[model samples]
Target: MKKSSETAAADRRLSTVARHLITTTTNNEEEENGSFMISSSPTAAAGQSVFSNIVGAPEDPILGVTVAYNKDPSPVKLNLGVGAYRTEEGKPLVLNVVRKAENLLVNDRTRVKEYLPIVGLADFNKLSAKLILGEDSHAIRGNLVTTVQCLSGTGSLRVGAEFLARHYYQHTIYIPNPTWGNHTKIFNLAGLTVKTYRYYDPATRGLNFQGLQEDLGSAPSGAIVLLHACAHNPTGVDPTLEQWEQIRRLIRSKSLLPFFDSAYQGFASGSLDKDAQSVRMFVGDGGECFIAQSYAKNLGLYGERVGALSIVCRAADVASRVESQLKLVIRPMYSNPPIHGASIVATILKDRNLYHEWTLELKAMADRIITMRKQLFDALSARGTPGDWSHILKQIGMFTFTGLNTKQVAFMTKEYHIYMTSDGRISMAGLSSRTVPHLADAMHAAVTTVV
Candidate 1:
């Protein structure tokens, strides 16, 4: 009985201590204005949010297009706002070679999930360098090119920009005035002062060569100039070989640095070599430049997010040093890229048969876009659409600048359930023969009624 009484006394003492601690904590919380918040405190009102004052942000202009498209219940709704390839039946395509490469990778039992070095896959880097700069490129032969696997075209661009902002003397990057929607945001957030050089002329539906030359000529020497190596986006306007040569000479003479974004290399002429002529021209001059390449379109590895950023330097040592610094920049961002995508790319690029097959497939996609372009043009002609729709054929790659204004685009969306960017850009690859007629009708109606 004495032992039991002792245990009861101990329990009472513990209970008293616990009550005292609770009272002390409550007093401290009441007295301290910056008291630590316990989310489950009884004082907290049920279902109340701590972020009540934070406002919702508007959706991104490009990505939001699809979000809006998905919400529309209309059966006839068409989404031409995104820059992705669709088949003649309006399905996303997976290249035959990509499937073959993936099959080989899957069957290889020896393939292990190993973390790539911060620089990424060695074979992918080397093959990517060769793919962009050519097999006989003196830069690669001389070991003056540093290549790193990046997260598709946009990631390559962002990595390159961050590197330049930290290392290069010039913090200003002059992008084409009407360049890709993400270019300005990418460069600016990397701490580079974003500027613009005139590129597109809406009036002629062509390049503003004189304006571009004037802007680049006046830019400070050593300032970086962004170039769409081939298949310029939105407008689909590309400078002819002669114009590219003149632009190259002007840039080199002015000592301006060129940074090429080659997202749609094989889409322009349906030939990789021919499409890369603009970038090859710049590299051929034996000057330093940056090239970011994406395999999303060509390899149809959109989900894989495989791409490369290649820096052509003056000497081997400089390239090595640049690579080391690039690693420092990347280590904090993503640590390293995934191996599956790089492995698939290496499998296809290393084998000659697969490479040839890939080119043929790429050509087929391009040809389909060409057919759609012609059909759309004919459809517009049949409707007698108000403007010169000839620009449809002139613009290359996945996108065509339709010259439709914001109000017209809204009209198209409201009345016809056809969706595209407010800037009047439509994805040529998103079109098919079956859908061209509806698009033509929408355009005719938008132009006729939305005055």
Candidate 2:
């Protein structure tokens, strides 16, 4: 009886402590004003939290860099995260041609805010196909090419994936090993099996041509392969024209379908024709292929989200049926694309003077990115930072894979106010002459101090 009484007293003491702790927590929570600590509506009287069971999703690594960079209050903070082009002053840029086109649209009172057709503007589709697949493309002249306006590169890719998923003979898709992150997600979500072919070689920081050939040769006939039309993202490594011809021959011989994601057309070589040689090579051969063209990077119409998907088939009869099915894929999702962005692109592309001016501005942007790469390379060299920095100069387009690991990336973010993806990918467009030294110092410290 005495032992039972002692246990009862201990239970009472524990209950008293638990109650005190609850009261203290409640009072502290009520006193806190910061959003980090307390909810905006802290009281239960407002409404019950219906999303209580929903788990917190992890932050997007790419976009999360921008978010973190924006939140940092440091004056020296640098954002080498997003691939969006920026002026030398580190400001987002809209091309003069884009502005001129917008003005033309604004002044033309005949233009209305009416919704576009399910297939999109006829002229925009025709012009976009011509832009990617030369003006004299026999497939287009023969009515064997089906073009549809979709969202920018990502949207175009998604729409194309959906169409392929529904109609293509095979379900397996071979993407590059170090491809744009969205490639895997987009294709997989479309209900297709995603596979990877060797592309980026870490040791050389270049293309693994032999491995790529072996992988493609081994893939089953009719398997779909995603090709970076130009200016491969993240890694910035692309196969040479000679290598591309060999790849095309192999793919054609194997009867594998090629889906070209042409995000950076004029942004790579600064010459549209030079950048499009690979796609044109495949098209010139009389086989089937898919192309997704984006105006975001080249034309600076990112917010406008203008792009198109072109399917080159064997004959006009097949293309007609394919286009009809593409309508079914788009009708349920978005129904039709936004008209303004497509209108802007169509205007500039159609006008000779504007097209020339657009190419000049596009070249300027590409040249600036190349200059930044050189500046960064020179800066790193001057500091005598360990490792071969030559890849900075060799890698093409807006991004450079810096070879920095995850821990080093975190160190740079914490010690210096520099931001980039954990995979060590930095947007060359985001770098400037002014910020090169800061990045150099941070990188030097990141590499030397850590290991």
Candidate 3:
């Protein structure tokens, strides 16, 4: 009886200790949950005490416009923020020439999907150089031009910038005022100081010729000056032939290095030869220059990302050295350019018939954009929008600087669902016959209502 009684007391004591332990654990868990809840609270999360101290970065100006446009629920919203060319129906277009080229590439059973050389395909580079520098270019005859395939215009620009940053002693690159939004970033990232020369004048809403001449004239000799070879971006205001000659002379006299960004070659005037005149003239003059050419706008190969960069030099020895250095720069950047786009371009350029067909198709696209410009101008004039609308037709390429202030642009977005850059540039390619009148009306309202 004594043993059984002792056992029962011990069991009761053990059970009491077990219940105390369970209650302590439960209390600790609840405390942990409360602490976590406090840490994760909205106020706490936003505070430095709870989260890391890194600040969020702002969205890209060009791409951010697209993001805002996408979120807009209005059915009438038009996205004129980007530089991409669109059909009259406001849809992205793939050129018929590109399709034909692709078909030819597919039919070539012997062609292998092999790695391209570090610089890119030999034939593609040769053909690309010929296309930009002309068939009888002295640089080609003398073998003084080093060409490399790149990831479209932007990529080509980046690669060229990097090469300059590494090799060129004068690391300062002078870009035009109100140039491509990304030019400054590209050069800065490439480890060069970015400077600007006068190009645009707000008072006249056109090129400031005197300011430009003075800026270039005063720029430090040997400094790199980036030139829009044809169809200047954002403004669409290009220097006339005479202006180009004077600019070229000044650049040569100042010993400034010229870097031509030829993004809209054939797309600008619908004639490849006409569009290539500036680049050809510079090269023909024995001026050491860099040319970055994109097939995106001209061939409608945006997604394919095809482009080339050619560096013209005074001698074959220098050209060879430059080519080697360019290969080194390209090695780490992307290793090599894509094969498909290069192949398509090569196939088209190699065949005479395909090349002729491609030119016609290019002309058609350019002609359509020209037509849109006239239509938009006519619509604006008919509506008597309280301003001279002739600049719409005067400007070339896919865009027109509408000279609308930020408030007017905002008004258009809020009241009429018409989207455009805050800088007042509109993508003429985005306007169709059906939408031109509507866009003109919206512009008229914004212009008159705001003031």
Worst 10 residues of 2 by lDDT: 30-39
| Residue lDDT tens for model 1, 232-303 | 987799999999999999999988999999998788879988888898899999999999999998888888
Q: What is the C-alpha lDDT profile of model 3 across 240-344, one tens digit per residue?
A: 999999999999999999999999989889988889899988998997999999999888888899999999999999999999989888997779888999999
**Which clashing pairs does model 1 show?**
none
Candidate 2 lDDT by residue in tens digits, 1-451: 4444324433543443343334323332221211012123333544657544433434466788899999999999999998899998999999999999999999999999999998898889999999999989998899999999999999999999878776766878999988886787677656667788999999999999999999999999999999999999889999999999999999999999999999999999899988999999999999999999999999989988999999999999999999998998899899999999999999998999999999999999999999999999999999999999999999999899999998899999999999998889999999899999999999999999886
lDDT of each: 0.86, 0.88, 0.84
After superposing candidate 3, which stretches have Cα over 4 Å from the reference? 1-53
Q: Count the backbone clashes (under 3 Å) in each candidate.
A: 0, 0, 0
Candidate 1 Cα errors over 4 Å, as ranges: 1-48
Winner of 2 and 3 under lDDT:
2
What TM-score, to 2 decimals, does candidate 1 have? Answer: 0.89
Candidate 2 accuracy as TM-score: 0.89
**Sliding window of 10 residues with minimal summed lDDT for model 3:** 31-40
